[model samples]
Target: MKKVAIVQSNYIPWKGYFDLIASVDEFIIYDDMQYTRRDWRNRNRIKTPQGAQWLTVPVKVKGKFLQSIRDTEIEDSSWAEAHWRSLTLNYRRAPYFEEVAEIVEPLYRNCGDLALSQLNRKFLEAICRYLSIQTSITNSWDYDLLEGKTERLAALCEQAGGTEYVSGPSAKNYLDPVVFKETGIELTWFEYGVYPTYPQLWGDFIHEVTILDLLFNCGKDARDFMKYTK
Candidate 1:
């Protein structure tokens, strides 16, 4: 059966995010949804000596009350440089920092002032390449969106020729499985927190930080600590 996952794009998301991507045959970037403030859409945490630190990408949201993530614009083009600097400062000493940096550093250096959705995709594709994940990534807008959250998700999965729809655990709070059942699509929840600890640089191990943390600390072996990268 063809498995599919539709998720909102996040800025340098945690390892679990990539695990979900790797678990599916087709992954849809659902940036057509409304952008939430102070959410993972424009920020993510990184491990530092002191503790986990946030690197937030400023976006233009002052007047736009209900803007979609695809429509969100970066407030400052320099946020990329600042974030790369933070990563360098915190993870320069990690075992695999240089190798991962060679792949990630150029993305930051060349990222232009693109929309939030476009920016997130650039990083996601780069990391997927590094991890050798071959899942097909597409956009939600590529298909005709239907009304209702459950209806829309089921429709997207069906349109993508997916017999099964894999979602994260958090969506169980409000996601109606009956919709998928009616559409004849099997529904499944992705499990997180199963990853093993790696050679992290910080004092305490935090699994919620960005995937970059795992990449810098474990390099090519980062897939060993993850559940579905293989």
Candidate 2:
């Protein structure tokens, strides 16, 4: 049975994000949804010597509170250099830092003036490839989107020929199971259970940081620490 997952694109998301992508047959970037400020949509955490630090992509949010994620533009191109500097300064000592930097540094250097959704997709695709995740990635706008929260998700799964829908556990609060039952699609909650600790650089390991942490520390063997990725 084909499994599908619909989630908003995130900037340098954590391992669990990629885990979700790898768990599915088709992973849809649901960027058509409204953009939320200070969310994973444009920012994420990175481990540092002091503590977890945020690496946020500054976006133009003034007078545009209701813009979709696909329409959210980057506020300044300088944010790229700044973010790259943070990654380098913090993860320079990581075991595989140089190897991972070869793959990620260029993405930052040439980020250019792109929408937040596009930027997030670029990083997501790169990380997926690094871990050999072959899941088919698509945009939400590619489908004829319907109305209602659960209705839209269930319909999208159906349109994608999905026999099962895999969603993050957060949706348990609002996702209506009846919708999936009517569509004959089994809705399953994805659990970000206790992940195995890797050779992290920092004193205390933090899994909430970006997947870059895993890449910088483990390089080609990163998949061994991840759940769904082969």
Candidate 3:
């Protein structure tokens, strides 16, 4: 059966995002949804000496609520350089710094004012490439389907020729199982349970930070590390 997963594009998302991508045959970037402030749409956590800190990308909002991710724009281009420096200083001593640096440093140099969704999609692609994930990824807008939560998602899955849709745990609350069944599709839920582990840092490994923390400390072993808990 054709399997697919749908998720909103996140900036430097957590390890679970990669897990979902690896688990599915096709990963659909649901970027057509509304953007929210102080959400994963443009920021994520990273490990720091001070503890877990947020790395945020400024966004320009037209109104109180984001109508769509496509309408959200990056507010400051300078933040990219600052964020790069912060990551460099924190992870310079990491085992995989050199390898990941070569892959991530160019992102800062290529920064420009773009939509939050677009920037995140690019970052997601970079992370997938670095980890050698072969899943085919596509954006929701490319489907040319209907809009709205249920209709949009169901139509997108159909357009992609997906018979099964894997969704985040939160989707369980709103998604009607019967609706998906009627559409000739199966709904599967993904729940990521990340166990705490020591990273290559000062002392006492932190948890729930961005996937960068996992990459920096575990390096090439990050993939294996994730599999242990699963």
Candidate 4:
């Protein structure tokens, strides 16, 4: 009864993202697809004294055409330091900032990787450890990728030895149920809705900020807030 999820790598994504990871037995970094700009692939939000702000990593795909997420490259080495500084500046006062910082700060400083997917995976794996999520994660490129939308996803799940597929809500758009049914695999959808708010600093609590907001504010208990028993 193995459950699997496949999603593009996101840069320090929101708590909901981690919740999906925690819910499954295997989580696949499906970054072999085309990269989209102004998406969570390279940027995410963090709360500030004034309001929410985006911390984005500049990529070198402006002139290049049809770059896959795994192939996307960071424009320069400076984004890491700047992003780390921004996080420290805004979240320095958070209740558990220092705790999470000690574990995550070195990632920013030591990032010599050029690929966006590699960097995203680095941060994601580190944060998953901090949250104690032990789900087995692998890259999609490691598998024999097929063509088409749902077919590729289903192929990846099957390659990962998954009996059930847990997908994000947006997959309802083009995910063909017939494919799963014919393949004798169960397909389930998970939505990150109405997240319970925890004690947050700065101002009114914002729910969609990066999971770092939850980690900095809730510390080790952040997992309790992000996941449910049911």
Candidate 5:
């Protein structure tokens, strides 16, 4: 049975994102949706000396609807440099710092004011390659799907020749199981639970940071560690 998973692109998302992708046959990047402010699109948590710190990407908003993640303009280019420096300083002692740095440093340097969606896609691809994921990754826009949540999602599955659809836990609230069943497609849900122990930089470990944190500290073990929630 062919399985598919859909999710919005997040900036250097958590290990759970990659975990879901790795578990699926085809991973769809749901970038056609509206951009939410103060969300994972622009910001994510990271470990720091004091405590958790938020690493945020600034976006330029024009109007609604027409706004696409591909159109999001970074507010400050210098932020990327600062972020690179911060990660280097914080994770320099990490066992996989050099490896992670080699992958991430160029991302920081090359990302000189680009679209949010483009940036996220690049990051996602990099992470997937690093983790040796074999699933096919695609974008929603590539299908030219119609508007509306259910319609677009169903259409995407059909376009991809997917007979089964997997969704994040959030879909449980509104997505009707019968609707998908009627469409001759089976809907499965996956819940992302947190890992009990992740690699620590300096202080007590912080969870839910970008996947980079996991890769930097845990190295190859990060992939297997992410599979276990508890």
Candidate 6:
């Protein structure tokens, strides 16, 4: 049975995002959906000396409420340098930061993708590779997108030939099980917690931050951390 998940691309998402990705057989990037501002689509948190800080990519969403994530563009070309510097300054002292820096720094150096989806996809792909996650990644636009929320997800699962669908716990409020049952797909929600605190650079342990925190601190053992407790 193949497990599949459809999710909007996120900017250097947390460990849970990769946990879902690693748990599924095929991970679909639902970028065709409308881009919502101030979401994980283009920003995420990182631990800093002061506290947890948000690092957002400046995107041009001036007046386009209906703009799809695939069409959203970066507001300026300079955010890359600033973000890299911020990451460097905050995480430079973390264990294995230098090792991860060699792997991730080049992504900032060659920033050519202007679209938010494109940027998120590139980073997600690289991070997955680093974590040794072999799940196949695809895009929502590649399939026939249906109309409603549950219908769209069910149809995408069918198109992807998924026998099971894995979802984040947040979707429990809106995801209708009947829709997946109609499509002959088993639905399961991923629950977070049971994350053991590792060596953090900051004063206290923060569970919710970008996956970079795990990678920089844990290094090659990052996959061990992404395996959420059952």
Best by lDDT: 1
Instruction: Report the C-alpha lDDT of model 6 over 81-169, residue by residue, as the tens digit.
Output: 99999999998988899999987898888877658898999899998888888899999999998899999999999999999999988
The estimated TM-scores of all candidates read 0.98, 0.98, 0.93, 0.97, 0.92, 0.96
Candidate 2 lDDT for residue 214: 90
For residues 1-230, write the lDDT of model 4, one tens digit per residue: 99999999999998888889989999999999899998999999999888999999999977777989998999999988898999999889888999999988999888886689999998889988888888999999999999999998898888888999999999899999889887878999997878788998788988989989989988989866876422
Worst 10 residues of 5 by lDDT: 62-71
Q: Can you give the lDDT of residue 210 in candidate 3?
A: 84
Instruction: Please give the lDDT score at residue 141 for candidate 6.
Output: 91
Worst 10 residues of 6 by lDDT: 221-230
- Clash count in backbone of candidate 4: 0
lDDT per residue as tens, model 1, 150-223: 99999999999999999999999989999999999999998886678888887978989999999998898998
Please give me the total number of clashing residue pairs in predicted model 5.
0
**Please, what are the lDDT tens digits per residue for candidate 5 over residues 108-176?**
899876788888888988878888888899988778686667767877887888899989898888777
Give the TM-score (vs. native) of candidate 1.
0.98
Candidate 3, pairs of clashing residues: none
lDDT of 1 at 111: 79
Question: Candidate 6 versus the native: TM-score?
Answer: 0.96
What is the lDDT for 97 in model 2? 94
Which segments of model 1 are wrong by more than 4 Å? none
Report the C-alpha displacement of residue 72, candidate 6, in angstroms. 0.6
* Candidate 6: residue 2 Cα off by (Å): 0.6
Model 2 alpha-carbon miss at residue 208, Å: 0.8
lDDT of 4 at 15: 88
Q: What does the lDDT read for residue 82 in candidate 4?
A: 90
Inter-residue clash pairs, candidate 6? none
lDDT (Cα, tens digit) per residue for candidate 2, span 119-152: 9999999888888999999999999999999999
- Candidates 3 and 6: which is better by TM-score? 6
Off by over 4 Å in 2: none
